[model samples]
Target: MRIKILSIAFAALIVAAAFTFIRKEVKVDVKSSQIAWVGEKVTGQHNGTVNIKSGALDVENGTIKGGEFTIDMTSIDVLDLEGDSKGKLMGHLKSDDFFSVEKYPTALFKINSVSESKQADATHFISGELTIKGITNKITFPATVTVNGDKVNAKATFALDRTKWNVRYGSGSFFDGLGDKMIYDDFKLSVNLSSL
Candidate 1:
């Protein structure tokens, strides 16, 4: 009877250990995280910052299993201009000619899968569905992710074709006879996130 009781206790300990290694959810520190964007045209380029509304990451044994984030489209700010110039550009970007922030105030990205990266600097390749202006598209990019104690940090930079989400304001692909006014279809986004 003594030996049987000891075996049962050992089994319970093993089960507890297994539970510790299960997936854990970490809430993102939105105030500390940042997302920057850059859009270029034939004449010049404009860069600005956007805010992450909320997010969380799923981690298991130091590996990121999944994650998702929401972007506040109404928080877009232009960094390269000042005063009226900045406000004008920001207003234009949030209008129907661009993101139409009044109708779709937020965007989202949900991770579908993650894999070990072949790049020397990046730690993983993240494949996910990105939704903007109410349209969702699959995008894959390399990211550097670090997990330490109860914290996680991830950084990545990638470019997406704006036309994919139907933001076709001054795009040459849709309009004609505009030489220097054509805005490039692809815009770049740089993301840095920290989880609490």
Candidate 2:
């Protein structure tokens, strides 16, 4: 009887280990070159990619595995703000009046809760924290993910207020005699992530 009971327990342990070994993890594909911020005829591009980082996950019943999506902010864009007058514009953008890249050069987003409302399309509502210019804010956005075999793709769009980060240069401080138009208050980001 003792031998039979030990054999059953050993079998159960093997099954549990196999299940853990086959568990899926969340993956990310970073394409930093795909980010841009354009306004008032000013546009900037990044070097290399945006760090395009990823993190661990827990998959439950084919769901997200866990309720977390994290990113590394040090992987953010360092705009190539140099080229003729446009280069000067980029310099201005990086100055203390604008992005203050010297002090705050990274932007971060971390998803805390992800809820699935549909099964066929795999639509999700992800809520997370966004940090910029040393300020942390909570934001919730929509992400649509499609899975095929071991590959996955997710895309989303969101906006942020430049003023919130103290990026106030040329925003409204323009001299009237110089006669300059103030840039808009909001900045938008479009993201498409693919994982394997």
Candidate 3:
């Protein structure tokens, strides 16, 4: 009876230890910038940083199980605003027309699957549920991961259509009225993440 009890206790300890090793905190960095034409002969680049909260990376056996990620939308800032007036662009972007910062303040990318990419450099492909403006979509992004000790590096580029998440204002046929020829629906995203 004592031996049986000891066996169970030992097994439980092993399981607990394995679980602990599976998940760890992570940090992700975002340096994506964009150039938008404000008017004739005028353009500016929008820049921002993504700060994550309570991020965790998990591994089961030899495969990555999942990771939880969030982006800090409050950090968004546009550079080179035409003249000293920058409030207009910032206010409009944070309004319900674009990201609706008041209602949906942050964007999230919760992991659903991880796979090995067929790229020559042994890249990793991650599929996750991306939530923006209260809409979630399962999207895939190609990440080139490099393991250095306890750290993991992931870099990739992706695009998002604002209209998909109900951000349909200031777009479409009104293109002719707008300063630019036509506001492009496709917005680019670039990520450079280093996690432990």
Which candidate leads in TM-score? Answer: 1
Question: Candidate 3: which pairs clash?
Answer: none
How many clashes in candidate 1?
0
Error of 2 at 138 (Å): 0.9
For candidate 1, what's the RMSD? Answer: 1.7
Model 2 gets an lDDT of: 0.58
lDDT of 3 by residue, 1-196 (tens): 9999999999999999878744444444333312122211114335433445435556555456688777666655665565445678777777887788888878887998889999875488889998988899888878777655556666777676666777666566333465643455656666666654
Q: After superposition, how far is residue 115 of candidate 1 from its true place, in Å?
A: 0.9
Badly placed stretches (over 4 Å) of model 2 are 1-24, 31-33, 38-61, 65-82, 117-122, 170-180
Query: What residue runs in model 1 are displaced by over 4 Å at the alpha carbon?
Result: 5-20
Q: Write the per-residue lDDT of candidate 1 for residues 26-138, one digit (tens) a residue.
A: 99999999999999999999999999999999998888889899999999999999999999999999999999999999999999899999899899999999999999999
**Cα lDDT, model 3, residue 157:** 71
- Model 3 regions more than 4 Å off: 1-50, 61-63, 120-122, 173-181
lDDT of 3: 0.65
Better of 1 and 2 by lDDT: 1
